[model samples]
Target: MTDQAHSLSLPRWKEPSILPGFGVGVGLTLTYLGLIVVLPLAALAIRPWELGLSGVWHELAAPRVTAALKLSFGLSALAALLNAPLGLLIAWTLVRYQFPGRRILDALVDLPFALPTAVAGIALSAIYAPNGPLGSIAAKVGIKTAYSPLGIFIALVFIGLPFVVRSLQPVMQDLDAEVEEAAQTLGATTLQRVIRVVLPALAPALISGVSLAFARAVGEYGSVVFIAGNLPMKTEIAPLLIVIKLEQYDYAGAAAVGLAMVAISFTALVAINAVQTWFAGRGRA
Candidate 1:
């Protein structure tokens, strides 16, 4: 009895599984994550260490670098903010209301994920170009959507939309409509039901989707460039600036900028995760 208890309490190197090759599965998981994710980030941090504090600071503080970083982080947040509510609405509609071509609409939500970034960029540029239909309308309003900061914002929103939609879909699907009916039966108005019940239930998933979208938008490159016009200190984004540094043979500078990117992304993710945690706890409470 003592020996059996000890064996049961031992750490699992390979978890008991119904599936075959648990050891190989674990090995492949670790190997893929280490190579594709951990190794690159580790190098990103280590490479810039050769540049001491002052050297890294100098690279990061360059006017163009600062501007690019500002634009990249700011626009990403804005795009993510725009996506959250819109995604929620779409997810709610898809799950709640049966409409014509519902399956097609559901499939289209993942279009950004499936589309190549460069191709998406070109297509967006064409749609918002001066001669394009929407561009003509915007031009009349003294607003330029392409070849400007607005264009970058648009591209980020386009690419980040899918993240928000997909993250909330599973959660929305699992939500019970009977709960809403219960609320209504208890003298809850439509607004009250949504605010007091639906919103709280959806809060955790909403935060998750928004955070994922923001992180993705921050790292976006190919889709933003064609639309941004790559104007230094004007419309350039940080990832593009990093590429410019590499092209200029300023490897240390590139790494420094990359380091800043990593730090910013890490900080945002942490803060968002904290918010998610709070919301999750609140929902439970």
Candidate 2:
């Protein structure tokens, strides 16, 4: 009995299972992760230190680098925030209501995922250029659409939308209409029903979608470059700056910029995850 209790108290390295090769599976998983994820990240972390701490700081604090980082992270976050509600609405509509051309609309959501980034960038630039239809209309209003920060925002939103939609679709499908009906029967208004009944359950998936969209937008290069005009201290982005550094054969400088991005991105993701956890706990309570 004591031995059994002691065994139960001890941590199990792996769960008990009828399936064989648990040890082999664990070994393979670790090996794959180390090779693909850990080693590369470790190398990146190590490379930037070739620049001493002050050198890394100087690289990050340069005016062009500062502006680029701000533009990349700021627009990425704003795009993700905007995508949340729009994607949720689209997901809810696709799941709850059948309409003419519903299948076509559903298929279009995945178009960005399928399209090459360079092609998408070119398309966006053309459509938003000064002489293009939308650009002409914007120019009439004294707004520059292409070759500006707004253009960067547009490109980020385009690439990030699918992440939000795909993440929420499965969760939306599993959400029951009956609970909403119950809330309505208990004197909840449509808005109240949505706020009180629907949102809590959807929160985790929504946050995950936003996180993915933000991360994707931050690292985005191909789609944004054409639209952004690559103006230093204006429309330029961190990833683009990294490329310029590499082209100049400034490996340490590139690594410094890359390291700064990683740190900021990781911090933002951690905060998002913390919010997700809080929402999850609140829902359970």
The C-alpha lDDT values of all candidates are 0.91, 0.94
Q: How accurate is candidate 1 locally (lDDT)?
A: 0.91
**Between which residue pairs do clashes occur in model 2?**
none
Q: What are the clashing pairs of model 1? A: none
Worst 10 residues of 1 by lDDT: 9-18
lDDT string for model 2 (213-233, tens) is: 999999999999999999999
Per-residue lDDT over 81-101 for candidate 1, one digit per residue giving the tens place of the 0 to 100 score: 999999999998898899899
With candidate 1 superimposed using the best TM-score fit, by how many Å does residue 265's alpha carbon deviate from the native? 0.2
Best by TM-score: 2
Residue 141's lDDT within candidate 2 is 93
